[model samples]
Target chain A: MKARQQKRREGRDSENALIFGDSVRKCKTLGVAKRAQEEMVGFMLVILLVAIIFLIFLGLASMRSKSNVRESAEVSQFLDALMELTTDCRITSFSGSVNPYKTVEELIRDYDRDLTCENGEKARDVLTRTIQEAIETSWVFSPESLYQGYTFEVDQTTGSGASSTQERIVELTWQGNAFSCTHAIGDTKSVFSASSTIKARLILCLSRSE
Target chain B: MAFVLVFTMIFFGIVAVIYTSVSLSNLREQVAELRERQALERARQLTGVPEFAFTPISCSSCIDFDKALALKQVRTYQDFWNIKFLRLEVVYPTPIDKDKECSLSVLPPNCGYVDIIPSPSGNIKTKTAFVDLVFWDKNKGAYVKVLGRVHISAFDVER
Candidate 1:
């Protein structure tokens, strides 16, 4: 009878040990699963952060490209305006004289009167404004834009070309910087030039009377 | 352990953001620089001498203080040339004699007049006749001067 009791106690102890071992194994598996989930979440968050950064970069690149295109178009417009102004000067060959207005305002007035567009004055104004802006903007890059140089010469005719005189030459020099470059928005500039006859000729004619 | 992992992730996220902003700003600056160079090149190319492409007309006024006038046109071989005013109007068709048309005698006698005296060394002889009158040409680049011999009678104004 004592032997049989010992056997039963041993059996009970083995069963309890088995149950405790199973529970420990289950706890280990649960811990590993929780760690893996945490790692996955962190990796996904990193990818999302990277994606956001990429999007921002893309947006900035797009903005830069657009700006470049706009600048090119502006430059093209300026070239066209300059060509038109130069072409207008060719008329001097026919009239044998130039008009007196050399200022931006005078140019605009003449342009407004002569331009034949449906938009007429408005179109001329716009073109003049564009040229003015370009010239002014050039100063932003180089201050000496307008100070290039001027040459003056005068010839006098008397007694029906029997005699003539050559007058003195004048040279003017300027030393200064007038260009201003700004990276900020809302800054602007304007430029325009009008036709003017050489003042030297008039001065010479007047002097001949003396 | 969880704290260590979160901290690592946060560190990487900050680095990525900084890297991206820097990259974008650098790209923008590069683009701006390239555009500026292109503009400068364009400016240089525009420096050539522009050809005579169009004429200013009918506007009554041109740039450079020049005036547009309704005058006869004269054709020239080149676009630009100096005018050698000739008295030979008979070379072209005319409705009236140029001398009769420009009768300076209609002015009051003794009006301002200039005399031409030519010496052996000079191009003209003494008592030479000359006139002061201006003519316009639509083709010539400058006003044509009416010589004295062409209108000798007009040059004899008593003034």
Candidate 2:
């Protein structure tokens, strides 16, 4: 009886050791899989970060290019030339055999003074007609044209500092179609009078045709 | 570990290539823009040249039509400017005669345009700028100013 009891106890001890060894192997396999999953997640995160950075860079580059396209030297030069153009509107008050005609620049200065031309036309009326004709002749705004639309504005500001008052002397606008413009190239020229400042601004809007 | 290292190297190599290409393209655009600006500056400077500039008045952007008419007579200016083409047109008062070219003999009121340098036979691009065309009007007995358009083709030598 004593021998049989010792045999049974040894058998139970062997069985327990075998079970523990199998469980340890299973645990090792699970740990390796878990580590692989963590590594994969880390790699994916790094790729995401790099992709985000690249996208941001591309966005910034496009924005910079767009802004560069908006500032055109041609438009600025045109404005300068427009200001110096001598119009047929001769100011009778300053009429001489030499230079009775007032330039677009001078007309802007005299607009506020309500001066009349030698032909008895108002300075403002002559200015508006001159600007309209010049712009129409220079830039043909049609659907097929590169310039889809344009805006020419003249503003007069009187007084100084806080007492300044701004008035719109002339505003002319033309559009080719209903489509919104994608970009605008614009420039402003300021002509100072004795008592006021006259500002002339020209903006050319561009649209891409389908 | 070796697999991860290889993948990372490949990824970084692609990123570097993309970055380099983008930077190179941007640089090319900037160079093109600079070239255009230089050409425009050259055109603006041409207006202030003594041969064409209006000297009597304090006008900086004025081109004397009288001087330009005389310039048309001097054939030496063609090669002196070294430009492909140079033309000026009066835009205001509707240029009484559109076909007539202004010269020392065919003065303003009779002529509409001046061909300082005639157009070369080829597909060439031109840059245009606005200027004040001023001249002493013999009829009006005073200096007359009109809208002028200056069209200049690219220079022969890169400038």
Q: Name the top lDDT candidate.
A: 2
Model 2 bad stretches (over 4 Å): A1-17, A44-69, A92-98, A159-164, A176-180, A208-210, B1-23, B105-110, B120-124, B154-159
- Give a tens-digit lDDT track for model 1, residues A1-210: 999999999999999999999999999999999998887887778667767976897798678745211233233332323322321122222232363212222333344244332323343444345334333322232233322311112222223243543322221112221111111111111223232221121000010111
Model 1 lDDT per residue over B12-53, tens place: 778778888888987986676565444433322222212211
lDDT of each: 0.33, 0.78
Residue-level lDDT of model 2, residues B1-159, one tens digit each, is: 566667878998998998898889879867876776677777777778889888877776788888887888788888887788888887766677978988776666577889888988877788777777888877766687777778888653244
Candidate 2 CAPRI grade: medium
**What does the lDDT read for residue B44 in candidate 2?**
73
Interface RMSD of each: 18.5, 2.1
Alpha-carbon deviation at A81 in model 1, angstroms:
7.5
Return the clash pairs for model 2, or none.
A98-B142
Candidate 2: C-alpha lDDT:
0.78
Provide backbone clash counts, one per model.
27, 1
**Model 2 chain A weakest 10-residue run by lDDT:** A176-185
Mark the 10 consecutive residues where model 1 chain A has the least summed lDDT: A201-210
